[model samples]
Target: MTDAELPEDLARLWRRPTGSGSRLGRPAGLDVERVVRTAVAMADAHGLAGVTLPKIGETLGVTGMSLYRYVGSKDELLILMGDSAFAVEYIDAGAAGSWNEGLQRWARGLWRAYQEHRWLADLPTSSPPRGPNAMAWMDAGLRAMRPLPLDRMTKVGILTLVSGYVNTSARMAQQLEQGWRQSGGVDPALAAQRYGREMARLVTPDRYPDAAELFSSGTFDTAAAPATATPVDPAEANFIFGLEVLIRGIEATTASAALDTH
Candidate 1:
C-alpha cells in the first residue's frame, strides 16, 4: 500500500469521526472498538490468516460489506486488533525499583502476552504502531528506561531489541509446543533423547567431529537439566538468557557513553 493509506487506516483505528459525508449519518449498532475486539477474538481463536473480514462480519451478525462502515479495510482491522490485544497494564515502572528491574519486568510482561496470544507474533508490523494501546505500551517501555543514561532514540532502540527478542522467542516456543502436541503429547525431554540417539547413529565423527562431540557432551540431556534455569519454563530458558545478555550490552553501552561525556 502507498504511504497515503496509512493516515486513513490510523484514523479508522482511532475512531476519529471522519468529516466525510459518507460517514456522517452512520447507524449505531456497531462501533470501532467492538469491531476491533471481535476481530481480536477471531484471531486469538484461530491464527492471523483465519481472520478475514467476512468471518468477522459473520460473527458480528453483519454482512461483510457492513464492516467497512467502522473499519476502512482488513488492514485497518488488523491494526486495531493488534493494538487492542496488547491493551493491557503489564508493568508500573514507577514502583519497579530500578531501570534494570523495570525493564526486566517489562520484557517478562510482553513475553507473557505473546504466549497468551500466540497469533500476535503473526500480525504484520509493516506499519508503525498508531493506536492508543500500542503507543501506551511503547510509552511504558520508554518509561522503564527513564533512569538510564541513554538518548531518546537509543532508549527506543533498546525497546525494539527487547520486543524483537520476545517476539522471536515466543514464536519459537509456540512452534515447538505445537509440534510436541502434534506428536501426540510426547514429552519434550523424551523427544530430545530420541532425536539425540538418532543423530548419534547417523552422524560420523570422522567428517563432522564438532557435531559428534556436541552430541556426545550430554548437553541435550533434559534429565540432568539445571535446577536454577532461568524463566522457570524449560522451553523459554534461551529467551531469558538472551534477554539478560541484551540488557548487559545496553548497560555497557550506556555506561561508556556516560564516561565519554565526562
Candidate 2:
C-alpha cells in the first residue's frame, strides 16, 4: 500500500516515545501517544510548520502549556517527533547475505523510510543521530556491516556516504513535492521553462557562458528532476545516480582497506 495509506499501527509509531525505564520521566499522566499522534496528523496536513505544542494541545483538548509539562520546548518536541517518525523497531532478525548485500538492503530501506515519511528529509542533521530512534537505526546499520573487514574509521566513512545520500535525496524530493502542491499542480514542462527563464535573468553568459548555453538549450531538465517535483519518485535518475555513487564508494573503500591491511 502507498505510504499515505500506511496502517494506523505504523503511522502512530512516530508518536510513541522511547521507554524511560520503570520510573516515569515526567508526571504520572502524560499521554505521549496523543501528543505525537496529533503532531503527525498535523504535519501530514500542513507540513512541519503545522506542528506546535499548542496546536497539538488543541488536537488533544489540552492547553498549550500542558504540553510543556510532558515534553520540553518545541525543539525537544521536534527531536521526539523526529525520533518517533524515523525510529527503528527491529533490525531484521532474519537478515541474510554477504555483508555488502546486507548493507545495500539497509540503505535502500532507509531511503524508502524517508520517502514514506517525507518529513524525515526535512529534519535537520544538526548533530549526530542522538535520539533513541536515530541511534537505534545507526546501531542497526553498523550491525549490518559488522562482518566487513574494516576499521571503525572506514565504517564511519561508509555511514556518512549512505546517510548523506538518503538525507539529500529525500529532502530534495520533499521540496519538489511542496512546490507542486503549492502551485496547484504545476505543469512539469512549464515549470522547467520558468526556471530556465529565471536562470536566464539571473545568469549572464559572459560570466557563465556554459551554464547559460546549457539551460538555454533546455537540454538540462531541472523541473523534471527531484529539486522541483514535489514528492518525486525515489527511483528517479538522481536517486540512481546517488546509488551508483554509494556502490562505487563502497568498492573503493573496500579496496583501500584491503591495501592498508596488506
Candidate 3:
C-alpha cells in the first residue's frame, strides 16, 4: 500500500479507554499497560520529546492526573515502555549455525525492534534497563553467545559491538528515511544520474580515464540502487569485514597465550 493507505504507526502507541469509567473520579479501565501503549503511539507520531503524560492523557481523552493512578510519573512510564518494547524481541538460539551467525541474527532482531520503535534509541541510557523485558532481551543475547570460546568480557564486547551496530545503523537509516520521506523519497537512480552528469562536465575523460570508465560502466547505478532507505543487510557485509579483523586479533592473542604456556 502507498503511504496514504498504510496503517498509522501511531495507533499502537495510544488509545482511549474503551468504557465509561473515564468520566468518574478514577480512570475506569486504565492501567499501566494502556498508558504505555498509548504513550508509545504518541511518541511514534511526535518523537520522544513530544510524549508527556499530559499530552498522552489528552490523546486518550482523560485528565493527566488520572493517568497517574495507573502509571507513575512520565519518567516511570518511559522506563516501563522502553523495557516493554525490548521484551517483545527474542533471539532464536537454535536457528543459527555458529556464534557469528547467532550474533548477526541478534543484531538484526534488535535493529528491527529499534526501527519499529524509532524512539527506542532515545530511551534514557542513565537508567540502565531495570525492567524485566529489557533484562530478558539482554539475557537472550547472552544465551545466544554462551557456547562461544570467548570469556565473559569478550561476550560483553561482542554484544556491545552488535548493539552498537544495530543502534547506530538504525538511527542513520531512520534519519535518511525521514529526510527522504519529507522530500517525497529520494531516488537512488537519480543520485547516480546526477553524479554522472556532474563528473562528466567537470573532469576531462582523458585525464580521468579510469574514473570516467568506472562511471560509464553503470556500477554506480548498481551501488546506489539500495541506497534509497532499503532495509537490506549492508550490515552483513560490514559485520563480516569487522568480524574478520576482530577474529584475527583474538586468535593472535590466543596464540600468544598458548606460546607463553608452552
The candidate maximizing TM-score is 1
Off by over 4 Å in 1: 1-6, 21-27, 92-94, 222-232
Top candidate on lDDT is 1
**What residue pairs clash in candidate 3, if any at all?**
13-37, 13-38, 13-40, 13-41, 14-38
lDDT against the true structure, each candidate:
0.79, 0.69, 0.66
Q: Which ten residues in a row have the lowest lDDT in candidate 2?
A: 16-25
Per-candidate total of colliding backbone pairs: 0, 5, 5
107-191 per-residue lDDT for model 1 (tens digits): 9888877877789887778776677777888888888888987789888888888888898888888888899899999977778
The superposed Cα distance between candidate 1 and the true structure at residue 128, in angstroms, equals 2.1
| Order by TM-score, highest first | 1, 2, 3
Tens-place lDDT per residue, model 2, 237-260, is 577677767777787878787898
- The worst-scoring run of ten residues by lDDT in candidate 1 lies at 222-231
Better model by TM-score: candidate 1 vs candidate 3: 1
Instruction: By lDDT, rank the candidates, best first.
Output: 1, 2, 3
